[model samples]
Target chain A: MSRIKACFSVLKESHKKALIPFITAGDPAPDLTVDLMHELVAAGADIIELGVPFSDPMADGPVIQRASERALAQGTNTDDVFNIVEEFRTKNDSTPVILMGYLNPIEVMGYQHFAEKAVKAGVDGLIIVDLPPEEADELTAVIKPLDLDHIFLISPTTHGVRLDKISEVASGFLYYVSLKGVTGSNQLDIGAVSEKLAEIRSKADLPVGVGFGIRDAQTAEAVGRVSDAVVVGSALVERIAEHAGNNEKMKKEISSFIGSLRTALDSI
Target chain B: MPEVMKNTNIDSLKSMPDKRGHFGNYGGRFVSETLMGPLEELEQAYKKYINDPDFIAEYEHDLKHFVGRPSPLYHAKRWSEELGGAQVYLKREDLNHTGAHKVNNTVGQALLAKRMGKRRVIAETGAGQHGVASATVAARYGMECVVYMGAEDIKRQAINVYRMKLLGATVVSVEAGSKTLKDALNEAMRDWVTNVDDTFYIIGTVAGPHPYPAMVRDFNAVVGREARQQCQEQAGRLPDLLVACVGGGSNAIGLFHPFLDDKDVALYGVEAAGDGIETGRHAAPLNAGKPGVLHGNRTYLMEDKYGQIIETHSISAGLDYPGVGPEHSWLKDVGRANYVSVTDVEALKAFHDLTRIEGIIPALESSHALAYTAKLAPEMDKDAIIITNLSGRGDKDIHTVAALEGITV
Candidate 1:
């Protein structure tokens, strides 16, 4: 099962929301991803969203974009992403893995093949940034039998009708894009977020996980108070960038940042 | 008046975008997986070497002594009389070495590229200005330079193509996409992807993933920093407003940075209105764009529902692009700056006005700033100062303008 679903189990028993730390799969260096994944989990990542590097990631911010540049620079593709996941499975079998990426590579790989490979490689969920909730029927049909959860995004711009569709379709959780703009923009209206959260909760049965712009413990706590989880990618990516070229420094820093974030989420 | 906006933490690490760029929604690392690692390395390298006294001192010395920065803040006495209203000041960025504001960033980025010990550099250009600047720096540093330009831009900007060749730069003509700036950028990125092991990609503006927007803005901020102090020393106060044309927004952003903290100073970025704003053929991203992703980062982009960029048109080849920097978006929302648009007709008229009155021909890109002044001057007081960035000299546009007028320059 997906670590995301397991997080809810931990949440139900501990009365604390989960902390999902996002990291681009190949950053600082491509060879470092699998090791970094283990470090993130040990550092308090209840769930790990491993981003597959794509040529274009429309939903990402600059930090993530830079990560993509590093991975793309090194020529890390979907096949490489699967290999990384397969390797991670050898060391960590209990943690659920989510392949968070755009749809181009999956489309290129063919849905039937991708679903099978992703499951065999130990991935439990998929979050294609560009796949709107309505258009996911084709992929869902292919993956439903495999029992892999399909995650859907719920933006502040998402209407009630769309929220209802996403809720029915999403099995893992609802990704709440905290703002209307793309990831890494500079402003957020708390009032707008609250209103959108109310809309999702009113219709969606799945846990609403808020992301985009949750960069610090203070901000993560603020978001954790409002939802079942707080997804922080840029913050973790920033730590990776902070210790570029030094594997030990990168891992240590990432763990420290995640530890702080875990404490913040649990406080809520 | 500046006291209200003065941030005392100007010299603190507290100003950084928290590794993730959470400037209260105005910034973050909205990039893809491939670039994240290298970007982090870049950030770390910048942190280690960028603030070194020697690195900063070398950069500053080159700016003042080599590039001849503190470029003149000239009083456009003649143009002011032509407008018959407000006093006008011209921030003469065109007087800088290499004949444009682009060299400022090129010099900074090139220096950083050298510090990283990268042996080769690649860049993208639209009007060839950035290509020429990059080529110049690569030659100075004895580095191999590859510049990508649209097949169309290579044709229109032949002189710059020749200059790059003379500088021993390989100019790659990109024909993919619309065969324009966007396509050229895509091609350049492809090169970076293939060669990131040994090559450094020098982006030309205040856009792209994190650190880049801030980094480019700092390099170009020399324009605003000098102009601000000069405007104060000479004019005895800050200008009532500041205006510049936007094209990848390097020149405008450079000129706008220092003034960002100046609350009373009204900043304006005039985008190319082209045929007209409503005609669906302009580059006025701030006026018409929705917040969609483009070119690896999220900013105001001219795109369709499917995220394919719509074709853009402008009198200036450089301004014929579909996005604005993220900083401009932040500024637009906070009301620190107002973005406006000017059509080809107004820009042409301003071009004519500057040529006839001041004997200075400006590039179509700079003409957008002139157009803003034409309208804004008539509305302000005679004593009120309005400084405009004459981003580049217009000699290269002589062929273009001559064709338009049915006369040879």
Candidate 2:
């Protein structure tokens, strides 16, 4: 079984919701990323979504965009991201690490080459934000034989035949963007999200992870009630932005924040 | 019926960007899932109305009365003589209402926004020509208009920014990622995704996901159609060579699409070589770029080996984008069009040369094509006809040109 599948299955057996904490790779500092990944796992994160920085992250809000800029300013690239994941794997091989970003960097790397490098680097899944399933056949074909999980996002706007299409191809989990806006947008209606989650669950058999607009432990707990996993990105990234230069303080704060989310998810 | 065309057969040139919007391996709906629904809806609307006689009539009616279409194909007799080779003609898109060829697409898209029952329209612009055009149409039609422009562009093109404001558009200054056209486009995409329900994104150029490249091209294709008819009527034959500046490639695609099936007419797309191609500071993606995806389509992008887009420079703000439309990439790959580059210095020279020789102040973007024409016209046979797309007027760029000469005015 894939690491992601096993991770979810174990969580399912324990009647616990998975906690996914996302941070841009090489953000704050490149040297601090692998340590942060280990810190996340130690803080009770079920899975880690490490962002691969791109110059233009259209789907992201200002917070994550700043993270990407910081990472890029540090000279981080696809190789650096893969190296971060590989380093994380050396210490802890059990926790699934999903690399999330736009598709161009991987495109430059070439699909087959990217898939091979990703699998070898111990990356468990992918969440290419801009790559819808329609344009994904080539990449999916390259990654199918490997153990990597090709995840797809289901937005509030996604429905009917489109929902079926995405669900059919998506593996591991379906990330449901809870709000219509980009990450870090303030408005998130729990009622709307739960309703959308119910509709998504009806179509896809895999676990549904709720992201976008998820900020605090309370909202994470609220999302945890209806989702298989709760993804917290901008809130953690915002914290990282605050303590960016002070790596020890940044890691400590991030650890406690993920701990709160984990505690909130465990209560559910 | 193949979803992706590998080879550009002459017969298939006009029917390109197959059903899934692939111009060979270029141009696909590569946006996030949230945008897929909106893009599909747009494609369906585009398909339905583009063929409708009512939509065509309405679009034409507006073009004739509002935008002053069939802009003259003027013979630049004095400049042609100065070049001393080919007889040069200027497809005077610079004379269009709103002072550029951008209005051609904006007028059509604004009409579509009306028909689709969208109450608001949004646009992204670089040099602000498209923004002014979009704002003009939105005002004429009584729709709420919002334009995303880079903060840097707003400073450079202050007149057009004021023009957009005068037309009642809320100008949003985008301050991210190089602070130029691409960043404005990114912000516009985010805005569209957030407000897709009530808003229509009037993509200024022939780029973006799907239906846009094809649809925008069709809207602006009137340029080629008229230029073809005009050249045949005035010059007594089709021009031997067609040249146009390509930035996101709308005007060039507009002129080239209709001439794609005309085997006798050679086409040239002039990209902005800011300093020079070798300097790594230019915006000539087709001339010196590799294929990558950004802002929703696969195209030739000025990106590093790591796939991060590099900031492009051009004397013309409109030409300062890292990528070209995907169709241009396909055309370049299949050898349907010749993609060339001219430096900012050359374009500035053309701007001055045209003003002196023809009493025409061409936009810096169009000056690229005009400069290339000066180079190519001198080399061609005396009887050979070269028609260059004068894409816009240079009034918007007077400040930049004046600053270069150390003159305040």
For candidate 2, lDDT tens digit of each residue in A1-268?
A: 9999999999999999999999999997899999989999999999999999999999998899989999999999899999998988889989999999999999999999999999999999999999999999999988888968999998888989989998899898999988887888878899999999889988889999999988899999999998999999999999999997888898899999999888888887
- Alpha-carbon shift of residue B261 in model 1 (angstroms): 2.2
lDDT of 2 by residue, B1-409 (tens): 2122245443567888888999989999999888998899899998999999999999999999998988999999999999999999999999999999999999999999999999999999999999999999999999999999999999999999999999999999999888899999999998998899999999999999998999999999999999999998987899999999999999999999888877778899999999999999899989999999998999999999999999999999999999999999998888778999999999999999999989999999999999999999999999999989999999988889999999998
Q: Which whole-number lDDT from 0 to 100 does residue B129 have in model 1?
A: 86
For model 2, the stretches where C-alpha displacement exceeds 4 angstroms are B1-6
Judge candidate 1 at residue B340 and give its lDDT: 94
Score every model by TM-score.
0.63, 0.98
| Most lDDT-accurate candidate | 2
Q: Per-prediction TM-score of chain B? A: 0.94, 0.98
